[model samples]
Target: MTGIAGVLAWIEEHLGIDAAKGGLADAVLRHVKERCAELRVSPQSFLALVERDTTEQEGLVRVVSVGHTWFMRDREQLELVVGRFAGRGPGAPVRIWVAGCATGEEAYSIVLLADARGIPVRVLATDLNERSLSFGARARYGAWTVRGLTAPEREKLATPSGLFEIPERLKSLVTFQRHNLVDPPPRGATGFDAIVCRNVLLYFTKPRALDALRRMRSVLAPGGAIVTAASDVLADGTPSSDSELPRALAKSPTAPPTPVVADLTPPAPWGAEPAPPTKAADAAPVSDAAPREAPAEDGHGAVERARSALDRGDVDEARDLLKAALERDPLSIEGYVLHGIACDASGNTYAAMASFRSALVLDPSLWIAELYLGLGHDRLGAKGDARRCLARGLELHAKAPGLASLSSATQAMLAEGRAHLVEAAAAKLASL
Candidate 1:
């Protein structure tokens, strides 16, 4: 009874997968058609199959995934971990989980690094895509995957066929498995010394990602850590829209001092994400205290400078500064809204709308972002989207108490930089 739009909504809600910007939306359509042909069913009937079978619905995760990976693509974290474990010399082989291991390059890279450091490690590599896992399990990689190895390192892994065949010794250290990270870690997969989920959480919605991180923390041995690509994190080492929102999410007694440690960059990390959770008021309010870097020189500083440039009517300067600031801190909600405004002032309505959407993706409660986004949509002649955004913004802004009663977990999310959202939303709606 549902079409493609409804199907996508289902996937986004259930699995927190946003196929829109990743070019996977079209792949969904293609996958549906292919499955229908394979099953000799109509599109409607295929939708029925997707609903009845969990496996059918889960297939979309694979559909959206690409397995283009080379060894040591992002190796700093791997090297760091090897050095740490090598020095500690845990009596037994250290256990590591490589989530979203595309075609085994990262997992194999970890093994080689640890081998070179004279430490033993057991890597449990996983991916939703079975094809990639199977390829990894084979322990044979093309020259590209081996290009990063030093001549001495390359000499150790000799193959008559010229492909880099992992030696049985190194191959023995890794185990490949099919897994869905959104679910709990597989059985026999507890108490890891470290978990390396590189650049993978960027594919997850914020809350969904946090949920996975919490799960990862549960299985980590005391003093163990979770490693992620540097670009994959937010201001405080998590991919939260509001810099302060995940403070509660980051807390745990048995976990390592820092649950998350980032590495490489996350790929174009803003478009769509989960909506805000039901607001809670029973918990005590948490004081704002995450990593507040250089009040005069960091993201906060850049945003203030951009504001000054805008007041001086220099839209270009403001936009450039805002862009740079956002590049450094994508979780800066103020920077995003201001960037949208600057874009609009520069007559780049589309970019303005995208910037506003990015803001909403982090914190939908931002009535200001919704109102401005609606305005952008209106300028683009998209009446339906304009009405939806405007109405939501106006409705949220109408709440009498207005974003003040945040729970201990999220009080820090919007506590700062208020006093303007309500005034602006109300003024815009009244004018309209």
Candidate 2:
């Protein structure tokens, strides 16, 4: 491996951050050298680019934090924002925050999405590093960063020269600031309706991630959601709950799953054999029972009944039957997946996520379950979880058609779901 790859590996191992191959590390090194020349960075300072901050100048930690953010990054999330806030009679000014907004893709993407719904928005876009923040304030992007938007979305939201010329109308909606996640958000910054911080948190240890999540929670307004890269989650380590809380986890774009052998779940009856590891006495209990659902008479029969109802356009009936099946056999992966799909069709998004979770517990390799999980999270406006589920599902499913065995009606719905997710992910990246 070259020096850059070595650095990439170090970053991944230490920070769990994805560093691009090729000369990206070289580019980051060069940028850091040029930017830190005044401070006379030593080898230690160069390496400190990836370290956690302890001093007041922590925001200056350098390393080109180019996220894979494109325009309109999560189209579905944007759609929800537009339709719910803008499509409805607009009243209160929508307050949004885009944290770790490297080069402004996420911030700009929100602008594009909000514009589509005709909802006026105010965004506070911030980053720890000044270099990335500078680019965000400029809002100029090249082709790679502009990939997600439809021609019209691009034209309407972007300047002719590809710079986002902040419109006076929208200017009141957005403010650029610098804030570090390691520390409290600057005193003046508090309370937001939604937060978009995509593809930037693979950079810290678990403790650091947890700290960032707590701080995010502190700033979020009631009913507000937080967004992250597809694979990232709230470092808060809190098990998700159904009770409405001040903060909730959002689904990010779906990324690939980790290697099968590396998965935390036990291996399936037929997949790869895993090496046994010694467990501590206090290790968390592994529930072999598939996330405990209600009992079913016959798993296969339940699937068929749900499928028939779905085919006949009885969406509500299908949902109800699927739920019944899950109640009958909580460990039934098929039942859980079908239930999730049905719930989505019936618009009970959170329940759909629970169903998907049950299914994932029963069968971690069920790519279809992951896809459903993504859709459910997206519907709940949990973009971060949605992105992770989708990305991991894509990794597991690869070229597999998740709805291949379903009837045309069901297939159509599945296809629509997939398309929406893909477009949403594309859009989320565009603003990066």
For every candidate structure, what is the RMSD over all alpha carbons to the true structure, in angstroms? 19.2, 18.1
lDDT of 2: 0.51
Score residue 385 of candidate 2 by CA lDDT.
76
Candidate 2, residues 103-218, lDDT tens digits: the string is 56667777766865667777777765555566567665544345457766656656554443445565445566656565665454555666665544543445655565666667
- Clash counts for all predictions: 7, 49
- After superposition, candidate 2 runs with Cα above 4 Å error: 1-60, 81-90, 157-168, 233-432
Deviation of model 2 at 21, angstroms: 14
- Which residue segments of model 1 deviate by more than 4 Å? 33-42, 53-59, 233-432
Error of 2 at 431 (Å): 21
Judge candidate 2 at residue 314 and give its lDDT: 48
User: Model 1, range 1-432, lDDT digits (tens) per residue?
Assistant: 365776676665655555553344665787687777888988777777777786776565555553345567545446766666766745767878787776778889999898877787888877766556667888875443465577777677756655567888889888877666667665556667777876556555566677777767666665566776433543235442212212222323432222353222222222222122111100000011122232235876787787777665455567877877998898877788778766664445555777888888887787767877775565344667777887898777766435432233233333332333334334334434
In terms of lDDT, the best-performing candidate is 1
Instruction: Give TM-scores for every candidate, taking all chains together and pairing residue i with residue i.
Output: 0.53, 0.44
lDDT of each: 0.61, 0.51
